[model samples]
Target: MRPFYCLTFICLSFAAAAQGVDPAITERPPSAAQLPGVDAPPGPAPRPTPPAARPSPAPSAESSSPLPDKDPASRVERLDALFADLKRASTSATADRTVDKIQAEWAASGSATADLMLIWAGEAVTDKRNGAAFDFLDQAILMKPDFAEAWNRRATLNYIASDYGKSLADIERTLQLEPRHFGALMGLGAILEATDRKAQALEAYVRVLEIYPTLKGAQDAVGRLSEELAGQRI
Candidate 1:
């Protein structure tokens, strides 16, 4: 039972509950301070991202083509456009849809072999076979080192395995490959909070909010941390 196993269990339980399944949220261990670290940042307020232009109604003919062709650069540009839309989304529902579109772009690796390996790795993670999942993900990265999605998936599995340091490292790599990755930014915030680096954790959450303002968790987290830090000054 790895340390991340408990966190994974809690997350799965939450997902189940969200789907109207009657599972309870699992409690973390006393030492599981990292889970709350995401809510402890006390640093100077992070600058909000400047608002981008509101997206025009997407062309109907191209709505079906969410995934880009084999051109990695083109795919990145596609993702960038989606992220821009997400940042400017006027409604939470719109932001949610944009996030899904971004994720869809990330899922297509442009290489059949790497994509297959990613599926295997995802299944392994579901099965709680962290070592096996890690191996598959590593192979995927080897097959397509520039695949930001593969690195992000491995970072998630590493977080679940409680290899926080490795998870953070992979997240950094993921961001280097795709800077607008809100998922990686959120993970980095969580790890920072767990390590008692509350200020940095807050900054990470702030970044996530900037990328996706309708993200409820980050919204609550920013509120909570802001109050906590303000109290300390009293």
Candidate 2:
């Protein structure tokens, strides 16, 4: 139950954020200091990304559709444009392409070491080696505190591990770093819905739509939560 609550918290938070873009209302996310291994000393220094792990970035719509600059500010600009394109996307194929580009941008964490670490973490997850994934993600975050996707990945890990408290914290941080993250928003909505926070969940799913109007899951969540809440009111 608690674990579900954690995922739901992330989902609800995300959905709500999707509806609103409020940077002023901040929530603490999982930081290195807050998770289990603050004092455990750093993991091994990141090695060169394994050939297979350094998989290609998500496919881009054009060879040069967005910014190629790698600074945080430039990443923001690139994401801003992709998000705009995402909002205007009329078909699922267009939306997915834009989403892939956005994910690719998230994967580019400035620090080559951190990026490689993230790739390793992703591979670990695929291999069902969550412990390894956690270690890699932790190190990645350690190296690049501003890498929102690392936090988001950890959030999913926490959710899968039934560590909702940590997952929710990670979700909060992910949103703080990148508020327009619909994936995180979806997680927040799931947590809220799981915990019976219907009104909040409804609000969250609604917001997700604001950012990504074509999202079928958020749309379904909104529809159901709205009907349920309305029935309760009646």
The 0-to-1 C-alpha lDDT of every candidate, in the order given, reads 0.58, 0.60
Tens digits of per-residue lDDT, candidate 2, 1-234, equal 000112333323222222221111112111111111011224554455446656568767774454557455777788899899989999766776676576667666788778666666655654567788788889889999998877877887787777767877987898788777776666666656666677876766676677767666666777887889989999
List TM-scores for all candidates, in order. 0.70, 0.72
For 1-234, candidate 1 gives per-residue lDDT tens digits of 111112342233223222223111112101111221011113331223556989767678866555448666787688778888988988877875675566556656677667656665555545566676677679879989988767766766677668898887777877787666666666676778778777777777677677767666567667777788889899
- For every candidate in turn, the CA RMSD to the true structure comes to 14.2, 10.7
* Best TM-score among the predictions, by candidate number: 2
Stretches of candidate 1 off by over 4 Å are 1-68
